[model samples]
Target: MAIIHYFAPMMKMRIFGLVFLGMAAACYNPPRNCNDFKEGEFRFTTVVGENEQTTTFIRRKSIEIDYYQEKADTSSIRWINDCEYVVKKINPKTPAEEKSIHMKILSTTDSSYTFEYGLVGSSKKSRGTAFKVN
Candidate 1:
């Protein structure tokens, strides 16, 4: 009985500690290898939620974003690295659906990559991945 009381709390604490470390690691973003990603003018298609749209990205120091609809709504995103970036809508007229996008390049081989993206705000969460065509 006493042994159960003693070991249970200690085991629980250790498990909780590991869970925290895993969460912290996921949030860490540094630099990426430049040569690994397609670093030029890119045009691609994106499907977010149920809405289908197209994006044309021009990469310089950051990604210059343009949306194709009736007209082009342009935005700018700063890159943490070649594969990670922080994006916020440039000038939102009516508070669109999402304010910010967290972009991640999942895997890279030769010409294409798998990407995962999410909204910055936790209240509005989104997750999607796409491939690059060059």
Candidate 2:
């Protein structure tokens, strides 16, 4: 009888702790500073076939030029919003390369943004974090 009384309060406390934790997690939100990431020199790092690669790009309001592996490629940007845009290769050399890519900033910090991107009209998505260099 005494053990039941002791365990009942312990169980209630445990349940209350779990509820508090869940509420805290549910209310958590990531920071965003969309305007800071809109136009700048940025570096994006990703893994490709067991190798890590980083690409650097300089963006203006409507254009971006990417430098990677001794090559430079330019793209036109169409803004959907302050935090979202579509990019198309300005001088694509192949059909696959001509597809416009959809990009959306998921969250931002003072110097970086987490983004999700995919080819326009495609369901597959990829995520990357880009850091502002300038």
Candidate 3:
């Protein structure tokens, strides 16, 4: 009886350890896939500290991305699928510099999608999941 009592504690400890390890493994899992996020046009709007901005993009051979805000003219970027692109500010200011931005589609679902992107000359990396508009 004494031996069974001592082993009971060890058995419970082992089972508890297994449960924790299982949860940790699930947390480290990768996303589903990236195929779903490709080949589509998307529009996104965000309210950043009382200022609202919108972005539109078409993920195609001639990929086009545009940005617009209140009281500002539309700006745009034209891209080719060869991992290269050109960006221009369409407003009449400064003749719009030509720059390049890096973007990658991460994973997607029926109503939401995630991506990794960065603007030109900026070292900050950005990632976010966005929902489709009705």
Candidate 2: the clashing residue pairs are none
Q: What is the lDDT of residue 129 in candidate 2?
A: 96
Off by over 4 Å in 3: 1-27, 70-97, 120-123, 132-134
Tell me, by lDDT, which candidate is best: 2
The per-candidate count of clashes, in order, stands at 0, 0, 0
Candidate that would win on TM-score:
2
Residue-pair clashes, model 2: 0
lDDT of 1 at 27: 89
Q: For residues 8-92, what per-residue lDDT tens digits would candidate 2 score against the true structure?
A: 9999999999999999999997887788987899999999999999999999999999999979999999999888999999999
lDDT of 2: 0.94
TM-score of candidate 3 to 2 decimals: 0.54
Residue pairs with backbone overlap in model 3: none
Candidate 3, residues 17-132, lDDT tens digits: the string is 99999999988844544444444566776677898767665544443434354343343545544333444554445533434456655566786676667767688867766555
Residue pairs clashing in model 1 are none
Better by TM-score, candidate 3 or 2: 2
Q: Is candidate 1 or candidate 2 better by lDDT?
A: 2
TM-score of each: 0.54, 0.83, 0.54
Model 1 lDDT tens row, 31-54: 444445535556567677898877
